[model samples]
Target: MAGVYDFTAQSLAGEDVPLTRFEGQVLLIVNTASACGFTPQYKGLEQLHRDFAARGFAVLGFPCNQFGGQEPGDARQIAEFCETKYDVTFPMFAKVDVNGSQMHPLFNYLKNEKSGLLGSSIKWNFTKFLVDRSGRVVGRYAPTATPDGMRKDIEALL
Candidate 1:
């Protein structure tokens, strides 16, 4: 019965953030990278946050360098890049492995609760996991899926 609420992750600022703080809110959790082809999706994610934040919706970004070393930067650098490049206002977490033995606990739960196209391991960066207000993992979106394309599901959860 463990859920997203049962996990905690370090923020881009290096502060510990308990996922329960976001309980009762629809969450779009994404693994991001600064130098990937999908890096531009940050703008769309920020837009989603702006459009639905007041309605109990949040977009949580976790920087991951496991893919092509696209996000190889310290927490400060990652935070700066997100703000300066995308004007991202949503929360961003410290870089973590998304697929492997060292994967973050939150991501392990996400993949177990909602596997993607072929399996539990995330295929690449930008993979998204949507959690309902109840802290249940509700959907898994591929890296190619755009943030804008998830509005309908987000609206339903909200």
Candidate 2:
């Protein structure tokens, strides 16, 4: 596959969304887990989305259960938790495997483009991949890297 735009992912609402729809926007693609310690990063991620959306920046969240089954919730439950707890307004996708044989194609492409400390395999929940406006994976951030801390990089892209 080429870049992120080459993939299609299911939305949290069960709609098929072509990544090409976001082709011209700078993206922060994250593997999220509802019950992980990094779950609170949703607030920061939402803040990022709100702060830069007008400038063509977006945060795309993908719920993943590959890590210790931290995100065990179904689509409805995950959507509810995100809306009620973090008031997240960014686009969120359905649950997917971030590693192993069942890994989503988008993530596979991302990891191949920008490997982290774990070398292409996602380390844990909240691992982030920054994509430029052209859909090229530009940066890979570890799970511990806070969304807020990535402002400068995101800003540069915008």
Candidate 3:
């Protein structure tokens, strides 16, 4: 019965963020990368955040470099790239490994809650997990899924 609120992650600023703080809000959790082809998606995600934020919705980005080392940057570098390039304003966490033995606990819980086409392991960067207002995993989206396309799903949950 464990939900996403049971986990905590370090923010890009190095502060501990308990997922519980976001309870009762529909969440779009994504693993992001700065140097990947999908890096541009950050703009769309930020747009989603701004559009639905007043309605209890947020996009949480977790930087991951496990795929082709696409996010090979320190916390500061990643933060700068997101802000300068895509103008990302959503809450972003520190770099993490999303598909390995040392994967962060939040991701471990997420992949288990909603496995992808292949399996529980994350296939690539930009993989997204949708959590409902009750803090339960509701849907999983592949790395290729775009933020704009998920508005309906998010609206339904809200």
**TM-score against truth, every candidate:** 0.98, 0.98, 0.98
Model 2 residue runs over 4 Å out of place are: none
Candidate 3: lDDT of 18? 97
RMSD of 3: 0.7
The residue pairs that clash in candidate 3, if any, are none
Q: For residue 28, give model 1's deviation from the true position in Å.
A: 0.3
**Candidate 2 lDDT over residue span 5-122, tens digit each:** 9899999999999999998999999999999999999999999999999999999999999889999999999999999999999999999998888989888889889988857788
Native-to-model Cα distance after best TM-score fit, residue 142 in candidate 2, in Å = 0.4
lDDT of 3 by residue, 49-70 (tens): 9999999999999999999989
Identify the leading candidate in terms of lDDT: 2
lDDT of the structure predicted as candidate 3? 0.93
